[model samples]
Target: MSVLVVGASAAGLTTAEALRRKGFRDPITVLGAEYHRPYDRPPLSKQFLLGDWDETRTRLRPDTMLTALDAEFVLGDPAVALDGHTVHTTSGRSLTADHVVIATGLTPRRLPGPDLEGVHVLRTLDDAAALRRSLTPEVQVVVVGDGVLGAEIAATVCKLGLSVTLAGPQAALMEAQLGAVVGGLLGELHTAAGVELRLGVAVDGLTGVGGRVSGVRLANGDLLPADVVVVALGAAPATGWLEGSGLTVENGVVCDEYCRAADGVYAAGDVARWRAEDRLVRLENRTNATEQALCVAANILGERQPYRPIPYFWTDQFSTRLQVHGRPSADLTIAEGNIGERFVAHYRDAGRIVGVLGWNAPKQTRAHRQHLVRT
Candidate 1:
């Protein structure tokens, strides 16, 4: 029962470890494109970007620890092909296994702009390092997008003594993920941090001089002068290499409730789009990465386990900690509080509670999640 895992990220590593722990003593191989060891990505925009943490501190398992798991390591080579039970790598290497797990994760979505020197997108370690080097008090940063990644980069750059202006196409920042009520609250936080918030605007194009970005023009004829432009528009699944692999690929690789794909193949993490109750869902967070990987490992060992749970996600911007419980929809109603110091918002679907968003109120949110099952 040999297993081959594509990607050495959180999902891949967790699946490998879970398989080993389940007593499947078959040969296992982990392939990664990154030469560096498997490292944590959550801190790349927060601590690592601000110089509060080092690259060595973000690793989930160092090289020595990964070797102890008794899995074959193939670093610096990306899996370029998936044919039945075999994987072909970019380094001219081929691997055959009884089972394969695709946990390729995601890549940043690039925007149309002039080829400039001081532009960046924070997804990997190299992106963070390059962006950090350009972070100084003298740099004026124009951050494109207001999602979690964009907000974090904006907050970090502001904390680093750089002027920042956050631009987003939506009326409210992070409105798609965090409903308008919470999005409005976050807007206030960014304002408090001295981050210029520009919403409901679209970038016309980028203007540069001497191969360096100078400023961005808006459709409204307004221009934002920036020394550094960081595009944090969000991410798409890194499944381009799997083209024509006979897998159902939408926004991600579609899988079943057990995380199984076609012909002994499985997928987890940001790359796996599995069936939920009403729809096929793909979560690009660590919680889903770990949980889905565990379920995949168990099913591979003939345990016949099914992955089912409420979706969860969290974000931190300065002192504000926003936590979301359960899957939410765009039409969900929001309940607000006075003063807005601490608020608890409920997301209802068909007159039943489906999600809850909390700010400085964990006890209420915890109780709410517990009651969801009972109600």
Candidate 2:
């Protein structure tokens, strides 16, 4: 059976590779919105932004590997709309397939404000390159968001010895994701790394002069001056083109447990929000991208397996590297090591371990993951 993948990033590429490995020798077409071939996105915030890695070094696959897949890659042309198993591109090209997979990923959310030169958001390679050219050790930078993307950008900028202020509504860094104890500790870490914290306030809007952003205005009538401003306010799923495609689209493209949105049509990665037993769930991490695609590929080949994976994510800031398995909560206790050093924190619910976090202690975290395996 012929297949069409409406994304060229991690999930889309993984799905094609999985399908090939599963012995499906049908024709495959991979569509990409960006001009660049599939590249790793995690490094865009840290390594690429810091100039530690160049553009070619960030590619997810080499030319030789892509050639071996033998799939036609239509780059620089974005899928503008979908009708059944047919996808229409911006170049007015229409292609139909027996099976269609949507792995369109996400688009970064921008703050609503006037058009300014210094304002930026990082989602694709072009965004990172544009932001990098403005970043210098001398310029005052302001990152508006307290989540993972904002925190990572702030940490990387501070490492360059640049003046940066993290503005957000959370009392501590990543409070919603890391909880009170770990989030408070992360706040201290950023402080130790020379990043100025402007927390507990909502951002009003952007203030600028001569069409260039000058500072970020907060709800409290305080303005934080900035020469370069990075808006890392998270992202939304890229499902706008599927609006009238007869697919259930809410926060994302809703699907069943098998990742099928409709017969002969499925979704994976950040774009796919599927039912997992009781509630609808969607994961935006790299691990889920691969796992969900694999499950989708298997189901497409008639295995009919459900996609139910325990969410996992990690982040590095300053000298600390954190790894989390399953869902962690604020009710945490020391499972191994100590708070001031490399330690493992266990999050329990109803006296049962639900998640495990390793603060610079990777081995201990894996050992504790067994406790949450049955969860």
Candidate 3:
């Protein structure tokens, strides 16, 4: 049997490798839109952008390791459409397989404006490299988002000695995930690190000069001067190719508990929205990408395993390492603590712990994760 994986990033690569590890030695083909090999994304906005790490360091696996999988890699050609069991690529190649795995991941949301020179979105390796090249000590950067990506970019650029302004419509940074209390603390952290926080502001458009982005125009008619603008406005699933493919496509490709989208078709990673608890969630983190890929591979191998994931994410900014495990809710009763100088917050839903957030407290946070797992 032939298996086709549409996407060559972390989720797709892991799925292909896991299939081999699970003793499925049938013909395997991996298709990637990008020409480069699969690389780690988390470092793109942090160490990679800061010049602390090179492009080679971002690779998920070395060439030698990937060669051992013995899968046919079709790079620089994206699957443009899906018809029955045949996948059509943008290069006009049609390949048929017994089973298909969709892991297209996400595409960054672009701002409504003409493509300016200094405006960038940090989702791909090339995007990070371009933004890094534009960064300078004298350059003033305005990041128009307060989410994790926006916050990380702002922090990285600030550490590079560039003046940065973080503007977003949210009342507090990461208010949806970390809650206002912890989110406000993060705002303080960014402010203390020389990042100007412009919260609760609506951006109208971008102002340009000589065909280059100059500043961010606010709805209230104020323009924030910017030498560079990074739009970390989140991303949308790259599932346009799956249109009319007889699969449920909501915000992402809706899948069953086993990550099955349709007969002989499965999905994993940021592109797969699976049933979790009573709701459907599409996780876009490195941990979920790897975990879901393995689960999908297992299910494909007839293990009949359900993808029950305990969501985990981490971020590094300045001198703080923020780690979180489990689903965090704003209404959860929080128990706060301080280990040495590190701050830790345990979120409890009812009497059972639902989530744990730690600021530079990895060990304690992991210990709390075990409790969450038991319950």
Candidate 4:
């Protein structure tokens, strides 16, 4: 049997690696839209953007290990359409296999604005490279989102001694995800680090002068001046290529509990919306990319196990490293430490612990991870 994986990023690469580890000697092919070798994206905004890590440091695996897998790597050609087990690429090439896996990941969302210079988005290696070149202490930078990516960019830019203003509709950074309690603390951290917080205000539009970004226009009719603007407005699953492929697409490619879209087709990573208990859940994070890929690989080998996992996510901003375990969406309460220093916060829903989080305290927070009642 042969397998065709439609993405060559972390998720796709991990799936192929897992297959090889499980003793699947079948011929495997990994296809990618980008020409770059499989690279880790989590560093793109931190170490890479800060120029602390080189291109070789960001690669997920070196040439030696990838060669050991013995999988065909077809780069730069994007898959455009799918007909059953057959995938057609833009270069007029078609590949069919006994099984197909979709791990295409996400595309950064952009606001309706002019194609002005100095405005950026950080998703791909190219995006990170362009934004890195445009960043300096000379420019007034405005990050137009309070989400994870936007917050990271703001932190990284501010660390470089550049003027950064984080503008978003949320009252605090990551409010929608971690709740107000933790969000408030995060806001304090950014403020302490000299990042101008323009929260609870929606961005009206972008102002450009002579085809370059001049400032960001707020919904309240105020303009924050800037020479560079980075739009960190979340992302959507990259499933546009799966259109007309007779697959269910709602937020992401809908799949069964086993992550199988059809008899011989499966999906992993951000592109997959699979059934988890009573709800359809789609996770978009680095940990899920590796974990879910292993699950999919097991099922592809006929293990037939479901992909139910306790969600995990983390982010670093300035001097703080926040770690989250399970779904931290309910009422947040401090389990240890305080807001002024390292602490552990737990989320409770109906008087039962659902999630746990740590701020600058990795070991303590990891100890409290057991409080999260797994579903």
Candidate 5:
């Protein structure tokens, strides 16, 4: 059985590797929209932005290693359409396979303003490279959004001898992921790093001088001066291209608990929304990418296994490594550990462990996740 995987990022590449491990000898093809080799994205805003990596170090796999897998790599050609069992590429190529996996991931959300030269987003290697070239001590970088990506960018820019101003609608950094308590700690950390944070303030619009971002206007009649603006406004699943594909698309391409999609198609990573009991969950995490890909690979090779993975996520900011296990929603009661050298937080729903967070405490959080009662 032939397998055609669209997207060669973490989820798609992991799916192909898992398929090989399962001994699927049929022709396996991995298609990528980017011209460069598949690489890890989590480091794009951190180590990569800080110039700790070189071009040769950015690739996920060397040409020799990928060739050894016997998987055909179609670079720079994105799958444009899915007509039944056939995959149509943007480069006028068609590949027919018994199974198709959609792992298109997400695209960075653009802001409403004049097209500015210094405004950027950190999603791809090109984005990181552009931002890296402009990182100087004289540059005053303003980052939109207080999510993990924005926070990381703010932290890294500060380390690079650049002044960074973080703007977000949330009251604290990582409020949605780490809850209010840990988020408060993050706010202090950013402040300690000399990051000028403008939280709970929405940007009215961006001010540009000669098609370059100069400052951002706030709704409260405040204009924060900036030479460089990084729009880290989160990501939406890259499902717009699949609008007429007949697959359910809410926040992402909806898949079953087994990662099985419509017809002979499947989805994984940030682009996949799976049914987890009563809720349709889409976890945008690397852990989810690898585990769900393995599940998809197993089902593709005729193994009837389900993808019931506990949602886990991690974020590295400065000296802290915050790890999350399970879902954190409105229904859960958040219980946080006292702020100390190391942080640990737990989310309990109806007295059952539903989620846990640990800073530099992976083993503790892993053990805590084991005690979680899946409803």
Candidate 6:
């Protein structure tokens, strides 16, 4: 049997490694759009952009460990189309495999404006490198979108001594995910760290000079001067290649509880929308990518196990490390600790703990996460 894994990022690499570790002696091939080896992405916005870590240090596995897997690595070539049993690549190569695992991940959503030199998006290693090259203490950066990615970029740029303005339509930072109470605390955190927060503002367009982005125009007719603009408006799944592949593609490639898209075809990571609690949900975090890939691999190996995990994610900004477990809800009754110091919030739904969030309270939050797993 032959297995073809599209995408060579964390999800794809983890799936391939899991398959081999599970004693699958089949011929396996990993296809990557990037020429570089699989690397961790979380550091790109933090350590890598800050120049504290080099490219070699970002690799998910060293060359020695990758060589042990004995899987063919086809880098710099992306699969453009998929037929029943054949995968077509942009490099004019056609690979036939018995099983195909789609882990194509996501593509950054571009702003509606001209493609200028200084406008950037942080998604890949190349994106980070380009953004880093343009950063300096003199440059003023206006990040559009107060989401997790935008918040991280703003924090990183502020730390680099560059003036950063974080603007978004949300009432507070990460309000949709963390609720207003915790999100308000984050808003205060960023403001205290010298990041100019422009909440509840919508960007109308970008003004440019000499064909490069110069500033951002707001809907209320205010212009925020900027030498660079980073659009962290979230991302959409990279599912264009699977257009006519006879698979269910909704918000993402819809899959069953087993991560199966079709017969002999499975999907994992950001590109997969799996059935969870009677609703289809797609997670883009690194933790979900790794966990779901392992589950997909096991299912591919003939173990009929359902993929049901307690959703977890974390973010590091400035001096705070926020960790969360389970689906946080604004409707749940919230019990919060001191907002001045290290804070912890316990969210309960109908007398049962549904979610827990912590700001610089990792140990206590982790202990509370067990409640989610047990119940």
Model 6 bad stretches (over 4 Å): 332-337, 373-375
Backbone clash pairs in model 2 (N, Cα, C under 3 Å; residues 3+ apart or in different chains), count: 0
lDDT by residue (tens digit), candidate 3, 1-375: 889999999999999999999899999999999999999899999999999999999999999988998999999999989998899999999989998999999999989978888999989999999999999769999999999999999999989988999999888999888888878878988999899999988788899989999999987888899999999999999999988788899999998888998988999999999987678889989999999999999988899988988898999888789998887777544445653358667777776778888888888777777767611
User: Could you tell me every candidate's TM-score relative to the true structure?
Assistant: 0.95, 0.98, 0.96, 0.99, 0.96, 0.97
Best by lDDT: 4
lDDT of 2 by residue, 71-190 (tens): 999999999999989999999999899999999999999899778998999999999999999996689999999999999999999988899999999998989887989989999999
Residue 84: error of model 2 in Å? 0.6
237-350: candidate 4 lDDT, tens digit per residue: 999999999999999999999999999999999899999889899999999999999999999999998998888889999989999998887598889998779999889888
Model 4 Cα RMSD, 1 decimal = 0.9
lDDT per residue for candidate 6 within 90-179, as digits (tens), equals 999999899999999999998886788799999999999999999976999999998899999999999998999998889999999888
Preferred candidate (TM-score higher): 5 or 6: 6
Candidate 5 regions with alpha-carbon error over 4 angstroms: 329-338
Query: Which run of 10 residues does model 1 get worst, by summed lDDT?
Result: 330-339
Relative to the true structure, candidate 6 reaches a TM of: 0.97
- C-alpha-based local distance difference test score of model 6: 0.90
Local accuracy of candidate 5 as per-residue lDDT tens digits, 85-124: 7888888999889999999999999898668899899899
Q: What's each prediction's clash count?
A: 0, 0, 0, 0, 0, 0
Each model's lDDT comes to: 0.85, 0.92, 0.89, 0.93, 0.85, 0.90
What C-alpha lDDT, on a 0 to 100 scale, does residue 327 get in candidate 1? 61
